[model samples]
Target: MSDKKRRQRLVQWPRVALTTGGVVLAAAATTFVVRTGDAASITADSGATPTRTVVAIPGPRTSTPPPAPVTVTVPGLPVETPVRVTPPGAAAAPLAQVQVNSAEIVYTVAGNQRPDDPVTITYADEAGALRTVENVSLPWRLTVIPTVPVNYVTASSNGSQLNCWITDAHGATVAASTDNTISATCNR
Candidate 1:
């Protein structure tokens, strides 16, 4: 071959190689973008077909599951006490029929004590906590559903002729006090 023809062929070979390499790089980039879901849509060569859309659906999140309900039975008791457990955004089950180690007691404080002359009344609550109610009017009645075994109430006044009584659910008198003294206590 001639010198000029050989030189021309060498220059033309590099151009051809560069053009092919550029096309290959472009095709690789397009494939990468489609696989990674970076492109929203892609069109066919003929432009006659509908554009294809790409979507990415996320998987479920990694989280700890909710705790289950627990039931605890007390010794010597026929009923079982349930420990309430509820998950997030869930309605808890209603605690019905929880009648273990509990009873209904009625407390009455009726006397000749006038309404203007109120007395201090102290009672043991369902949790065995002493709750004092001062300046209470006469003929005060309280029905306490005690969680403990026993309950009591006391009415205190200065020569008020007070009367106090504690009764059970069956209207049986557990304790009574009808003294016209400084304090009258009824315990059961």
Candidate 2:
């Protein structure tokens, strides 16, 4: 402890271990730039208390998404085609053949038929598939025909309280929700 004061404490212990390894490598590079740097802003003094980041600068990506005016639900019950779409060298919008036409039903029967009680007319189309009209006579006017727009029209009898109607061909009465009691359901 006397050879020049032990060589001046081994050169001041390597400058205090290289100044504590450069302050711990600058606090591990400021905690790796605050956990994987995007660095909107970061300041440090007393244990680093400077952070205000909200980096989400993304506003430029519409390669083709400004053309949306096509609403065509065709196959059944929805037919309104106006289709519009063009953005990417443009010019391509010509494909429409919406032909869905079929409507006729004058299934009327005005009461009182008891010749052994026989006046049955059960009809259901539009995929449910069932068409029938049996032993029709008296005050009846059957013509329940359709190509796809009539789901039902049933007229049963016990011989009293009978006033069924479903006319369309100027006899107008489009859909009164008669899914019961001398049933009739169209426009679906």
Candidate 3:
């Protein structure tokens, strides 16, 4: 067409392009805003409110009173000296006894052996019977040997007293007759 007509058409093309770009940008912004607002409302509704409910458990409402005490009397006792015996299911047995079989000795040395230096001895009583006796004493012989010997001797008896003697390898008396039922350790 003419020169003025071509110039007007070129100007109109730029305006149309700008209006199309503005409409596309507005549509994208509206979609983003609407989607973000819906997501925020869903999260707030789920988290901000909570439902409440009560649970009940059943049992006895009140406690019961204890049973009354019962009295008991033993025969052969005086009327004034009434013995109070506990009911069958009231209390349990308290005391117990254990029996042992044998005894053991543990010895320790500090330095070189000398006739005057005292020896140390330890005894563990494992005898079951209460009347068993364990004796500890040094030998009478003063002979110098490779190692100084400490003796542990045990005696058995039905009675409480245990009478025994401690002697050296030479048969000489280290300690005279001693009486003890329980286990003991002595150093000379």
Candidate 4:
């Protein structure tokens, strides 16, 4: 290479380095100045107090006297007060008379009774016929009641015959019975 060309390249290297360093220094200084000025403005605005204005003044306070107490007396006959009873219609209705049809029975066997104990059965009287015996000849339905613990699984009806079986805790048959019109009690 020629001597002038080599000298020109060496001179350009220092200029390039100086330009990059200047750009980096300028960016850092600009960021520092912006952050410092923002912090100073925030601190000054937060600590500064508002100017006060003159307002009206009230007169001196005074204390007031307490009121006199009045005593009450009652003519008594007995130490214990007697309660007066009120009729039902004169007041609100009692909560016991309210009827709730929807209810679920939770069965749990404890103590000496086995979990799979046999259930007893009882019968409820069927509804009487509304019409006279000579006017209508309708078949009667029997209602069976199980006294012991049993869960009703399923009931099937075929013609005049109705078969039903109740199960205990161990899935054992507690009672099984079949009846036409007459109610029968079945126990395992």
Q: Write the per-residue lDDT of candidate 2 for residues 70-167, one digit (tens) a residue.
A: 34332223334343433222234548854322465555545556667776766665444777777676455555456666545666765633445555
For residues 43-144, write the lDDT of model 1, one tens digit per residue: 233343443333222111113333444444323233333434342223335588533223677787877785467699999998889999999887788888
lDDT for predicted candidate 2 compared with the true structure: 0.51
TM-score winner: 1
Tens digit per residue, CA lDDT, model 3, 6-114? 9999989999999999999999999999999888678656654332332222111112322434444333233453334432122335576533222222221111233
Q: What would the C-alpha RMSD of candidate 1 be, to one decimal place? A: 28.3
Task: Point out the worst 10-residue segment of candidate 3 by lDDT.
Answer: 57-66
Candidate 1's TM-score reads 0.44
lDDT of 4 by residue, 1-188 (tens): 99999999999999999999999999999999999988867755674533233222211111222222232222221233333333111223566775422222211111121233332222221121221111111222222233433333222122223333332322233454544322223333
- How displaced is residue 23 in candidate 2, in Å? 99
Superposition error at 157 for model 1 (Å):
1.0
Backbone clashes in each candidate structure, one number apiece? 0, 0, 2, 1
Please list the C-alpha lDDT of all candidates, in the order they appear. Answer: 0.67, 0.51, 0.38, 0.35
Q: Note the residue pairs that clash in candidate 2.
A: none
Off by over 4 Å in 3: 48-188
**Model 1: clashing residue pairs?**
none
Candidate 3 lands at a TM-score of: 0.25
